[model samples]
Target: MTTLRIGIIGVGGIAQTRHIPAFLELRDQCTIMALSDVNIERARETAEKYRIPHVFENYHDLFSKVDAVCICTPNKFHAEISIAALEAGVHVLCEKPMALNVAEGEAMLSASIKADKVLAIGYHYRFMKEAQAAKKAMQDIGTPLVTRVQALRRRKVPGWGVFTNKDLQGGGSLIDYGCHLLDLALWLTGNQKPISITGSTYNRLSKTPNQINIWGEYDHDTFDVDDHVTAYIKFENGASMLFETSWAANIKDDQEHVSISGTNGGLSVFPFELYTAKNGMLLNSEAAWLPGNEDFGLSQAQNFVDACLGNAELIVQPHEALQVSQIIEAIYENDKS
Candidate 1:
């Protein structure tokens, strides 16, 4: 068994909280060999805490020391770091909204293909136990007709890090939070190519003078990103989607829902339920229990390591991630029109 040497770029909260822990848990298969960040002090501290061998201020300098790299940088750097890693002959597992837009995503994809390396997007929602069950159950629902997605949060705009920075993170809510559910919906529907999209984005709440918020506080006047977004998409395969997401909305509570109405039956993710007409009677079925590891982050890390070792296929392929980026870009563009 060849244990992969894994490097982590950007020693930020995501790296500390999710990627590092997940990769560490899979220590038998992969080792966190090196880490890098523009903040060299944080990188050194994280390296010391994790007992990782090497730390570098430059990501390019750390690449040669590892077989793969997990990019946890802001949206603005995803494509740049990913391309550099891939071109260095290292597999890449980049944090999601693969890039700021489709063009960058395509370039990242090209780099991966050119280097013949694995390019896995960090859409870890698909690795959840319920999501895995839903993928298998999708066959029972027949061809998908419509998908409804709502990733709503009640006054919980992240008040930490570069989340509110439009230049570093691009759009908010839709790009930061909504992209996860959107990726899952598209994946379950066989990655249907979206043909048309119309969308609206709102930042009025964040831009208000004073607001009630659960996730700390931000400078209202300086807020320049969408806090809410809604869209309608038509796929080439005749499947349509109604998508709504928000970081701060007047909703009852935070909601993360994805449901698909198919030609034969229907299914909903989140709680994992199935609906159908069986034997001339209406039927609804829910899982009494489900299988698979519940920790999506660990499962996602394992999958990436296995793919790097050629023992498994990537769950979130580069092109599928690019499709998600396409829709996100379209939605932001539609907001302008």
Candidate 2:
């Protein structure tokens, strides 16, 4: 078994909390070979903490030391770093939203194709135990008619990182927090082509003075991204979706829900429920026990490593992730139009 050598770009919170630890846990399959960040000191400190061998301030310099790279950088850098890695003949596992928009995503996809290397997006929700179960249960639902996705957090706007920076992360709740469930819903529904999208975005709550927020505090005057977003989409296959996501809603609690109604039956993802009309009766089934790794980040890392070594297929393909970017871009564009 050839162990894959993996490098991590951007030694930030996501890298330390998710990517680095997950890859470290799979030592038998892959090794964390190198680390890089704009903050070279932080990268060196993270490398020392993880006992990783090589460290570089430039991601390009670090690419030569590893067979694959996990990009945990901001949305602005995802495309540039990914294209560079792919062109360098190294596999890439980029953090979600694929890119800031569809154009950059297409370039990343093209580079991967030209390089003949793997390009996987970090739609880690797909690796969740319940999400895995829901993928298989999708077969029972038949052709989907309508899908509903709600990724809401009540007054929990992130006060750390560049999450509020429109230029760095592209958008707020929709791109950062909501993209996970959106990607999962699209993947479960077979990546149907979106025909039309109608969306509305709001940041009035986030921009208000002295707002009550659960996640620290931020400058209300500089809050430029959307805190709440709602969209309705129509797919080419006659299916439609009602999507709503927020970072600062007046809702009761944080909710992450995805439910699909289909021609045959219906299913919900968060709790892994199945709704079917069986034997002339309406029934809802919930799994008392589910299989697969409970830690989705670990599962995602393992899958990326396996795919890099040609041992398994990527659950989040680049194009499917691009479709997600397409939908997100349309939503934002609709707001402007």
Candidate 2 deviation (Cα RMSD): 1.0
Per-residue accuracy of model 2 over 120-203 as CA lDDT, tens digit each: 999999998888889999999889999999999999899999999999999999999899999999999999999999999999
lDDT of 1 by residue, 1-337 (tens): 4999999999888899899999999988989999999999989999999999999998999998999999999999999999998988999999998999889999999999999999999999999888888999999999999999999998988999889999999899999999999999999999988899999999998899789989998999889889999999999998999999999998888999999999899999999999999898999999878454688899999999999999999999999999999999999998898
TM-score of each: 0.98, 0.98
How far in Å is the alpha carbon of 293 misplaced in model 1?
A: 1.7
Question: lDDT per prediction?
Answer: 0.94, 0.94
After superposition, candidate 1 runs with Cα above 4 Å error: 290-292
How many clashes (backbone atoms < 3 Å, residues ≥3 apart in a chain or on different chains) does model 1 have?
Answer: 0
Candidate 2: residue 335 Cα off by (Å): 0.8
Q: How big is the positional error of residue 235 in model 1, measured in Å on the Cα after superposition? A: 1.2
Q: How close is candidate 1 to the true structure, as a TM-score?
A: 0.98
Worst 10 residues of 1 by lDDT: 287-296
